[model samples]
Target: MDYLRSTFVILTVIMTILTLLPFWRNQAWWVRVWDFPRLQMATLSLLFFLTEMALMPFGGPAAQIVIVLSMACAIYHALWILPYTRLYPKQVRASRLNNLPTLKIVTANVLMTNQQSDKLLALVEQHQPDILVTLETDLWWQAQLNVLENDYQHTLKCPQDNLYGMHVYSRLPMQDPLIQCVVAEGIPSMHFRVTLDSGDEVVLHCLHPMPPSPTEDDESTNRDGELVAVGHTAARASFPTVVTGDLNDVAWSRTTRLFMKISGLLDPRRGRGMFNTFHATFPFLRWPLDHVFHSKDFTLRDLQRLPEIGSDHFPILVELALNPRVGKGQRGLEIEPGDQFEAREKMNNAGVKSRHVHTAEN
Candidate 1:
């Protein structure tokens, strides 16, 4: 009984610390990684709190303190994720008038090593998105996706074996298409202007920065830096914009929120659901590493997390309408009091000195 009580107390303390770590603006991968599991942490914290309460009589004052702290952690974590749930107001307004011009996009990370082109191709054919952005694509994956070239005529390819590759294919005509590395070496993000069938032009930026994991980089600095840089670019762009890809960060992270404020873009998932996309193989462990954010000029037509396609990540499909008139109703974010200084600090810490994209080699 004593051992059990000790173990529980230790775990509660650790989880409580993890729940508060992301608030400090620390770039350590371990600490920032905690930001990905808020939902899970909330659940676990609640469970721990209940268990602590049940055992409070058997224990002592220390047990009481643990129970109270765990309860607080549970509440805080829940509040952090509440906005991403249906309970909160949607940041992007939904459009009922489907008659308006819409752009449907499907963004997927092919898991670089996962040889499942057929599954992805099937989804593409079924969804028939106006634009398709694939991340972690290698030369082999690019070749596999070549079949899409006929339908998606405007193509931009940045295939690499480095697991940071990207490719964009669009049925609509695209202008000023660019492939750029916004942070780390060999990692590429795509930037372009797509002319909708209605003849309206919208700028698009796609990213798949490396996560803070042992398999990848040491910290979230580069990831945060790339996002700030992109956010700044999106803010200054003349046309309405959309940014999408496997961002390698969760929607609830501070960096993501900062990016939203810096760019003035809205997340369609605000009131929809988590739509957790990564770790398709594990039901218990997953988060929304994939994302799509757009300017106030657009409204949500439809959004979905598509069925798994044999990769670690399930693709996300979103349909948005370019309606500037309804933008007033949408919930948007603005730069915070210290946002400029923080953005600059993040950019500097990320060590991302260049935004040049390395062209894909044959």
Candidate 2:
């Protein structure tokens, strides 16, 4: 019994230490693989508490101390994941740009297999956004969406049977709408430059990358690599950019945070609520996977999760304003340059790359 207790205690301590290592103590090779320390901390803490309850003789004072420490670690993990409580107060930024917002855009992942085209069309007509992005679109889906071409003159479409099909429609002038094969697998993504009526130039990148799931990719490394590489590209671009899609990753994950840092993009959800979109059929398991991240030049006016239209994912509509007065400093979060460099290097090292497609000059 003493040996078992000691083993449990030692393992718990090791995991707790590992959880704390990612942010500060260690950046060594082994630590990088176990980089998501918060997850380890939470899991290990739960295991320790469960072990104490299962043991024939409950742990003594030492065990009580361990429980307290474990609970603290768990709380820390929760704090990071649920950052809005700690980071955003009153659900609004103090920046001056919030005064005047810009064009409204809608992004939806209408599952290709979903049959309700009329419902989706109805929503599009009702919303009448300046820009619309649809993912998981196949050739048939493309045919169904073609009806909106009358209103939206500028368009980009990459319809496929695979999970990566994407389409973008814009009422504003779109320059250089082209399909880019970012990864080697010929997975198509659309990139273009949009000229808003205000004469502001905004670069738009619409992507639908395969996420890591048991039935999907064997690991999340590819998805992480692709996202980071795109983030690097977006960061380097001159124009203010908007990246929208079903990223297949949660908003609060370490990978997403690293992407935001490298891309210098602002998540509207930071001060707002989590606009969970996926698994529309199962509301309980849904998460904020579909995202619209923009450069600091833009201020979010409003964001809402639209009603479902037979797809497994709900649409996200956001109204943004070009806040010329809003500078990068208005971003409440601070990310280290070293971490950004490391994230970019890791992405490049993984062999995932992005390609730029130049549309014809308007």
Candidate 3:
């Protein structure tokens, strides 16, 4: 019993640290990464708290206090998670009429080493999406996607082996397609205008920012900088805009939330579900790293996570109807006084000196 109590107390202390670390909102990898596993933390914290209480009903005051701390940790994470659940109101309204022109996008981070091209190809064929964006695709993967050219004639390809390669194949007519290296020279993002059948044009920005990991950058600064940079750029777009890709940050993270408010885009996942797409091999350790965020001019037609394609990340498809005529679905994000200032600061801090220009080969 003593051993078990000690174990529970130690777990409680660990959970408490995880809970408090995110509050710092530090761009350091260890601190920011904790934001990605709030769901797991909430569940584990609550479980440990209850199990400890049930097992040690007559524990000393110190043990009881530690148990209570675990419960508090659970509540803190729950508050952040609540907005993404159905219990909270959805940020984007659902599509009521099918007649509106719809733009369906499928975004996936295909592990560069995974050779299951057929799996992704099958999914693209099944969905018949208007635009398909794949990340971490190498020259070999690009060849595998060649079959899509006959269908998705409007193409933008920036193939590299640095695990940041991006390819966008669109059935709709695309104009002025340019691939910009947002932060690093090899890390590219696609910017283009796709004309819909309704004669309306919507700007599409596809990005796969490098994540904050030991193998990758040790800090989240680069990811946060690229995101807010795009956020500011998208904010200036006059046409209806959509940004979809593997953001490498969760929906609830400080940077992501700041990007939302700065860009004034709506997340379809809010009130729908988490639609967690990463760690496809590990069912218990997944989060929504792949995302689809759009301007209020669009409404959710359908958003879903497709089957695994042998990559660490699953594909996410979101069909949004073009209907600014219907009025903004939700109130625009109230850009706090510090939001824009902090956005600029993030870009400055990351030392984003790139011209963000595209090569001649679009």
Candidate 4:
């Protein structure tokens, strides 16, 4: 019993520390990276609490304290994730304007090294999304998806072998198109206007920021900065906007919430489901890295996590109905205090030290 107590107590502290690491808002990869696994942390914390209770039902005060701390961590994470579950009120309302013009999009991250183009092609054909956005695409993926050009006349392609490459194909025509590296060099994001069947023009922004990881970036500064910069742009845009891609940040993360509020955009996932899209190969270790967020001017018609296509990510499909008259029923988020300040700091941190990069064709 003494041995078990010592082991579990130490592990419990470790879990609690890691769970609280993201609160520091530290940009270092090791610290900020913990933001991605809140769900997993909650699970582990709960398990530690329960197992300790069952195994050592009667321990000293220290043991009891450790158990309580574990439970606290679990509750902490659960509260953060609860808004995303059906139990909470939706931030973005359901669509009542089904008759209005709709746009369906499919966003996929075809691992740059993965060669299974047919699986993705088949999935795209099956859903037949009006817009298809592929990330981690290279010159090879560009050639394989040329067939989509037959149906999707308006296209934006920026194929980079560096794993940040992004490509977009749309059935609806695109205008005022521009592609630029918003933050770090070699990392690119695309922006443009899409004219829907209703003749309404909406700004579409596509991004796949470099994630904070040992193999990738050393900190979350670049990733968070890109999101901040885009959030400001979307907030200021004259027309309604839609932003989607593998943001490299989870839905529940602080950065993501800040983005939503700063941009005044709504996440269809809120009050829906996590719709975990990454690590398609590891079901237990997945989060919603791929996302689609839009202005309240639109409402959700459909959302699904499609079958994996030999990539680390599962494609996500979202169908939205656009009708300016209908969104008044939906709840919207306002920027919180310090949101602008923190966003500015993130942008400044990346801009001051990082090399500027530009890849554009307006």
Ten residues in a row with the worst lDDT in model 4? Answer: 353-362
Candidate 1 per-residue lDDT, tens place, 274-332, comes to 99998899988998999999988998999999998889999999999988999856767
Model 3, position 323: C-alpha lDDT score: 82
Taking the tens digit of each residue's C-alpha lDDT, what string does model 3 give over 228-338?
888877777878989889999999988999999988888999988899998899888988899999998998899999999999999999999988867474765688888
Candidate lDDT (C-alpha), each: 0.87, 0.73, 0.87, 0.86
Q: Which one wins by lDDT: 1 or 2?
A: 1
**Cα lDDT of model 3 overall?**
0.87
lDDT for residue 229 in candidate 3, whole number 0-100: 80
Candidate RMSDs in order: 3.0, 5.3, 2.3, 2.5
Q: Which stretches of candidate 2 lie over 4 Å from their true place?
A: 1-66, 85-101, 327-329, 353-362
Residue pairs clashing in model 1 are none
Candidate 2 to truth, TM: 0.79
Give the number of colliding residue pairs in candidate 4: 0
Q: Under the 3 Å rule for N, CA and C atoms, how many clashes does model 2 have? A: 4
Off by over 4 Å in 1: 57-59, 351-362
TM-scores for the candidates: 0.95, 0.79, 0.96, 0.95
Q: Which of the numbered candidates is closest to the native, going by highest lDDT? A: 3
Error of 2 at 261 (Å): 1.1
